[model samples]
Target: MTTETEAISDDALADVAYLSRSRNRITILEALRSGPHPSGRLEERTQASRSTLERILTELEERGWAERSPDGYVTTPVGERVIGEFRPVVTAMGSIRTLGEAVAWLPDEELSIGLHHFDDATVRRTTPNSPMAEATYLLELMREASVFRTLTYIAPPLSLLQSMRDSVVEGRMTATNVLTDDLVGYLRERPEQTPYWREYVEAGARIYCYRGHIPCNVFVVDETVLIANNDPDSGHPCEFIETTDETVRSWGRELIETYRRNSERLTPETFTEESRMSAEHTS
Candidate 1:
């Protein structure tokens, strides 16, 4: 059996030292995340006793996680990088574990950058008895927002459409939506729903259809999104995340904008032609 000392390389061991799992040490490092701070301030911020603070600070300085300058103690570049990478994982993992396989709805790259946003967000799990819970919660989120944006794999149901129409008519909200190419085609084929979408267009909601890229089911209400997996045939419980984290919301908006920029405007005249063009290109 490899001893702990023999198993870890010198460089790896050094990193471990910097990120020592000691609660007090970790607290001190987190307290310095805002900027440099004097010893007194660090003690107060971390709520670590003077002796504990002193030891951790000394260790941090030795490990290059901190530096004592004329003004105060500051986190070093290496320390910043470690914290930046580490904290997000720890924070996001809480949500990811709850989300399970449903977390794959967001692109891997976007998820990495925005995971921290959902650190304090809530997750709602849906069962067969409450199949419409996700949509209901999404509508409530929309109702709470002054401005909303969304990327959807499925078309809005009549109930959601009516609610959105009421919100728009009352001047309560404005929205932009991006739908997958296939959904747009599906809507075009369904005559009953055509008027609903047309009414949305008349209410001043902007709509676009993305041809490529994987479909995402996300609803962004101001700084939060109702996010869930794109599974339509799964019998397992569906997981949804509702978050107001600025980073995640910003990324969600940017994601929609990227599709919007590359997508076709969903006007009645362009619907058929654009759908055909998208199908040909995708094929």
Candidate 2:
């Protein structure tokens, strides 16, 4: 007695087994991503010999995925659907091995739930010697955004901090910055730069200090683009994932809001007092 749900599960398992059985078939399917191709062309692209290609093609046609067309062999609508369903799985398998310790910076629950939203995102990586590369890219994105929000686990590069201040000063962008307490302590140590941060406050950039730890860094620009960054302390190369996918954007926005809700607003007067007391303690 196979229920409808059980039938669907069986079909799905069969499809998975079929796809996993042959690397040659996978190559042919991926080659078809650009569009239809003649058997000869597919042979060249997939690097499968004629006999092997013909067998794969026959199997694909029987599966309702490949069809003979006036132009050549094209993937059918069913094939396209199958490819779409497998896209995130393919992307995850490709990227997961490279992510290293950076993967730990994201909440396990969030990653488990929404990691696929990152399938189409662009990743930027930086070497230890090039620590500021991703930050520079982020600044470029910020310059093009009218409104931006950031949830940061680490202090931003000084150059980027200055650029945000300049953008606020010039009335080019509005920003909301959420910071960990550790970053606030660092700012306190550099009292000389406190006035610039005050200017940032006056220029309409709001700051919030989260009472506890935030695992990753998120920047949402114009509510359209989201950038997720790993902690530099992770010992792996720093990396950032940028995406315009609306689902990913929403996820980033929600992460930012979570931090904001747990944070206390930081005003210039309060910040100055905090910095002064810290300076006194250190002196």
lDDT of 1: 0.73
Pick out the ten consecutive residues of candidate 2 with the lowest summed lDDT: 96-105
- Please give the lDDT score at residue 214 for candidate 2: 77
Screening candidate 1 with a backbone cut-off below 3 angstroms (N, C-alpha, C), the clashing residue pairs are none
Runs with alpha carbons beyond 4 Å of true place in candidate 1: 1-10, 17-20, 33-38, 70-72, 109-114, 235-239, 268-283
Best by TM-score: 1
**Model 1 over residues 138-184: C-alpha lDDT tens digits?**
67766767887888777676677777777776778897988887887
Model 2 over residues 1-283: C-alpha lDDT tens digits?
Answer: 9888766776888898898788888778766655888899988887889999999989999999878888788788888777767766766665554444435545675543445665556667777698777767777876777888888766655666777888899999998989887877777667666777888888889999987877767778885554455656554323666677787677777778877888998887645856669656876
Candidate 2 at 227: error in angstroms? 4.9
The local lDDT score (0 to 100) that residue 91 gets in candidate 1 is 69
